[model samples]
Target: MKQNAIRAALAAVFLTAPVAGMAQETDLAKRVEQLAAELEKVKAELAAQRAQAAAAPRTAAPVPSTAPAQAMTNAPVSTAWATPAAALASDTVFSGYGEVNYNRPVRNASGTQTDVRRAVIGIQHRFDDKTKVVAEFEWEHGVVSASDKGESEVEQLYVEREFNGGLRGKAGLFLMPVGLLNQTHEPTAYYGVERNFVETAIIPTTWREAGLGLSGEFGDGFAWDTGLTTGFDLSKWDPASGEGRESPPGSIHQEGQLAKSRDLSLHGALNWRGYPRLLVGGSVFTGKAGHATPGFAANDARLTLLDLHTRFTPGAWDLSALWAYGRISNTEALNATFVGNPTPVPSSFAGWYLQAAYKLWQSGDYVLSPFARFESFNTARSYAAQPAGLGVPATPYERVATIGANLMVGQGVVLKADYQKFRQDKSLDRINLGLGFAY
Candidate 1:
């Protein structure tokens, strides 16, 4: 956007130079000086803008949207959280995103529902050029109350400080640099109505922890981050419930709510973006989950997860793929304690996916990108060994195929519709429609 402004200003100068020379014959020299001054000012302004643009963290979501990048400028505020990066246009910047969705099962007609999936408000306030504060509040499922099935939570709250040598540090609650979507799941940032099951079920999307961390970049296009943070508390696990079978870490995460600090977790990630329109990165997060809680059967247990992802945007094509795996250590004894439970602790879970999208058409400020994704996920790939004739049945990998299109309206609003087919659970197959915006 700043580039466009620069071009327009230069054009004005060139187009008006001759006119001023002819119209102001007596004060032509003075007029020329005025124009030169204005031109210099415009250039300086654009240069500053370009610097800030360079400082904003780049996302791994598909490119060619052009809309989301401009979403911030279209908003009421001048900036948003620029983490692992530095610079903000205003001292107090408000930026956010929201999405509402409708889903209907293909075969089970009774399972039709519309929902206000999520609404989020993010604020980034710069205390100085080197330091800033970022806080984001989120409302999920529309309403929030004791009786409502909705929730209100703090998605992120942290203070970041820039140090010499290109290093940056942040403290407080922050989102982990995990999977592709975990750091950039702003509705419009991804395709489809619901997030792909592989990410949500295997990696636990929106995962965050309270901790301190450092980030920096070097060597052409390499960036690295390492941090110590709060982790899961296995004592909270419910063997009687199927939560573990859904998302193991998510079911036991602390989310910084009086989080147990007895056993902190460590995480690290490295990314490379030297190639234009291409991004490749991988991350690892591992920690003990017992938190040393007394009488915990899995006191010696640990959790480890890792993933590799890549996104390449060439011309009108947006293509990406990811693979993630997670493990729970020493769950055998833990599962023995829940012998009769319906859902025992799983030994491991993993998933992978490949997705592609094409910019099919464009008109004015509207863009339509049709996409397809195929994924195979297993939340319960294996269980801890149990007594003979008493173990839970073996689980099958669930395969999914999703075909969808996202229509970008102007800068930030997007209309999406998709159909998803499930291989193992036909009842889960559904058609979905959604409207989302980021600004």
Candidate 2:
């Protein structure tokens, strides 16, 4: 009986062993199949990614870290004045420009001196692809204190919105699209140690106002700009001081400082660049200046400015010309208030300049440009009628000629030397050496 039981048990064990082995084989096969399916899925995903990358649009590779400055140095000079039309940089960008100078009066050595002319810091923050904010803070001279000639001010503060079809609008303080330099007058943007007299004295370089403005660019090489903004305040005019004699608009310019919005100004500009490396444009600004300020004598005063400018860059040559004329109406009554002042309100002022620059030499990121400019301006061209012997005679046009050379060390750093000759006042002639940078 014991032997029979042992045989039965052995048979049962052998039978179950085969079934268990089969189950193990089935489980192993299932795991292999699952792993194979996962491998195929990964392969499909990688192929899709490769195809998408191939179909994507090709973009120019970014410039190497060392090439940005070199590329900017070689860019066309017209790009320097992008202003409101310039595209917003991706993310946040920091920029700045400044200059330090040494001036020696040719006739008086005692007047020789070296000083910091200006330092500026600017920020551009992009909230999205189409909206951005820009601001610039500047310090003039070196120090800003109660007794120093230095000052701190906002050069620009504005928010810009980009619309469909190359149109852009900006509000807050912004530069007027008037002259070649007003919008892009960084130290590295121009050829001289100092700005041209016509732009600086007549049109007021770096002129800006607070208001709304529109700018548009077209595919046909045409651009347009228009704006309504705060204007010069005649109530700020000082007849006793010679400030007005130096720059009529600069003296009375509100600069958005507690500006009087009672009077708004209109400005418009049109530009054409149909030809290669050539640009021509014109601008006009007109407005009432009195703002109905209480006790102001020139309530009816009207200010009008007109300008025509052209620029051409051909190979190694750069040529530019500009003419500007300004007039203030109803100034006769205002001049009567300045009976004893030698400098009275002027009815009209005009200026013109012609400049030429040659790319004399270039190597790597270094360039040398020699330039010459001739300009004529009359700040006090014609004063209003005053009582006998009370009237101030119109000053003769002052002619100036500047010869200079600019040495560019990198993308935005320059060393400049120039000699200025004054036809009206030789005593004002001087030699200037300057170092300037922008980024």
Candidate 3:
């Protein structure tokens, strides 16, 4: 009995020792799990704090100004941005411009029109310092389908090359460097809601053609560009129609879309910026536009234009002027070929405009410019010779005076208001408002 009792006691002691060890192990495991969870929480909090610190610098950073450096280099700070060549980064760059306009007639003309005039997006890709490709897509009146009252276009698609001695070359479809407005028609670039009458009527503002061109700078602020380009087509001319009244040469322009290449034209321009804050330029274009029409007897329907323009900005005042003269030969022969036209084509057209604007106020991000403009144009200044009574009257062209103010909220955004007076026989007046942006 004594031996059995001793054995039982020993067994109980061994079992109790194992139970105590299990309890201690479970408590240690629980403590390890809690420590792991605490470590994870601490890690998450540190990551969030690190992220906040990294973003704070960017949010509070200031935009750097290069204006002082530009001034020191004698470079004009007119655009308030880096130079085109310097602004591009290693990546493809994107830019765009847009405008919305409203017009109300104050005279014999009826109705008002509001239009989303244009939306343009452009992209540039640089292969290297010497070569780049640029393209622009345009939407007019917003909608894109042919069934709508809107149109879409590839405004620019060109490859440019930089060579020695400030020389540059471009090939493919591009804006013709004829007038000031043709090359820089972003709404914010000009003063008014509508483009000037002289450029629109005579110079054919926004003109572009498919061609190859060379441009370069010479001695002391002199630059020149010349190109061979596809010319207009006289086959599309319809004399008795309202479309012909749009512009002298623009009405017949095919805009380089699968253009008829039978007749090519030469154009040249020279610009001199010898004086500070002043630029003077002249351009010429001459070509036979008939495109070798089959039915016409005199198919050499030649067109020629000469334009002179200048812009001067002195302190608070800005002055701009342009004069353009255009002529078409062999129009009589071409008019005779028109199947059902009651009107005759003009032989000569001329237009001119002068503008002055003063910076009324500028502070911080706000700028106000009050401007005035005077214009005169004659689309049909003289007609091709015919029986006196057979052709329509070609007399004094229209004259106009415009006054306006442009308020800029930022470098790339503007609000414009203007009043226009037509001073001609059977005149019409109008008020215009517009909003514009570019980047």
Candidate RMSDs in order: 11.4, 14.7, 14.6
* Clash tally, candidates in order: 0, 0, 0
- CA shift of 125, model 2, Å: 0.9
Model 1 TM-score, 2 decimals: 0.81
TM-score of 2: 0.82
Task: State the local distance difference test value for candidate 2.
Answer: 0.80
Model 2 steric clash pairs: none
lDDT minimum window of 10 residues, candidate 3 = 59-68
Give, for candidate 2, the lowest lDDT window spanning 10 residues. 61-70
TM-score of each predicted structure versus truth: 0.81, 0.82, 0.80
Return the candidate ranking by lDDT, descending.
Answer: 2, 1, 3
Tens-digit lDDT track of model 2 for 1-439: 3334445644554455444578876865665566556666767876796786556533221111101121223332322223332233225667788899999999999999898999998887777667878898999999999999998999899998878886788899988888777876788878789888899889998889999988887767678889999998888888778899899988999888999889899999888776777778889999999999888889889889889998777778778899999999999888888888877779999999999888899998898999999999999899878789888889999999999999888666899999999999999999999999887
lDDT of each: 0.80, 0.80, 0.75
| Candidate 3 ranges beyond 4 A from true positions | 1-87, 108-110, 338-342, 425-427
Instruction: Tell me which of candidates 1 and 3 scores higher on TM-score.
Output: 1
Show model 1 residue runs off by greater than 4 Å. Answer: 1-89
**39-102 per-residue lDDT for model 3 (tens digits):** 6676787679678755543211111110111122111122321234434323366778888999
Give the runs in model 2 whose Cα sits over 4 Å from its true position: 1-90
Candidate 1: the clashing residue pairs are none
Count of clashing pairs, candidate 1: 0
The alpha-carbon deviation from the true structure for residue 44 of candidate 3, after best TM-score superposition, in angstroms, is 27
